[model samples]
Target: MSEPTPDAPSGPPFAVPITVRGYETDTQGHLNQSVYLQYAEHARWSLLKAAGIGQQDLVGHGVGPVALETTIRYLKELRAGDETVMSCRFRWGTGKTFRIEQTLTTADGTVAAEVAAVGGLLDLTERRLIKDPGGFLRELAADPGLLDR
Candidate 1:
């Protein structure tokens, strides 16, 4: 990734707007359970994009992100045609892992779901967790501040 431009977005809680699609719904007409995770994943990638980090950037560095665990709380039903926003935020600690918190909210401000995940950067060659995932991400990000809380 290159350096952040003067107009790059700043800080955390990166958001991506979405519209629930008919194909993403279950027989019950609510969003599929697994799709919530997909939405969260999309938001995370969008955040990376916003920070000017691309898959090649991480791959070239021999580093890739992995999700160790994820938990989701379904708060409300999301049907097809519902406009929503998926937001992502990263919370880093002292080690190789970090916490990813995300929320799926409807346009009317209803929170449809919340997702929390444990993630880390993997060293492709070694197939081991990177010693400092946050540091590695910061190095890859054009707007490092976007990773900050």
Candidate 2:
């Protein structure tokens, strides 16, 4: 597969480096497809943490992020010992739903996979989706550097 150009849009602003472990790979010596989704999930949580959102905050607001849908494209294969940088960004959608775009790139900048997920804040007590009552999306939109960590 062709690697994305340096000038290409780099998905999200925040990145977390990860090293592929033998347990994460399949008998084919490549990363398991399910693991890519796990990586994306990890990156999203990291992004939220960097933006000052955490489990405690969610619990305090009686809301938590829930993924409504997810789609992933595998571009290249990752073997054990490969180092990758996973990045994530947020995009608002209708109502309480928002989109998260994540990319996993190899040390040499080859994109191994891309994941897009539809998520929203779920009212833990009400068991339903809720609008941005805490201004999380607003804060994210206003500050591009919020997820720079």
| Candidate No. with top lDDT | 1
Residue range 111-137, candidate 1, lDDT tens digits: 999999999999999999988777778
lDDT of 1: 0.86
Write model 2 residue lDDT over 50-117, tens digit each, in one string. 66677787788687789889999999989999999998876653356766778899999999898988
Worst 10 residues of 2 by lDDT: 1-10
List residue ranges in candidate 2 displaced over 4 A: 1-12, 137-149
Scored by CA lDDT, what does every candidate get? 0.86, 0.75
TM-score to native of every candidate shown? 0.91, 0.82
Clashes of each: 0, 0
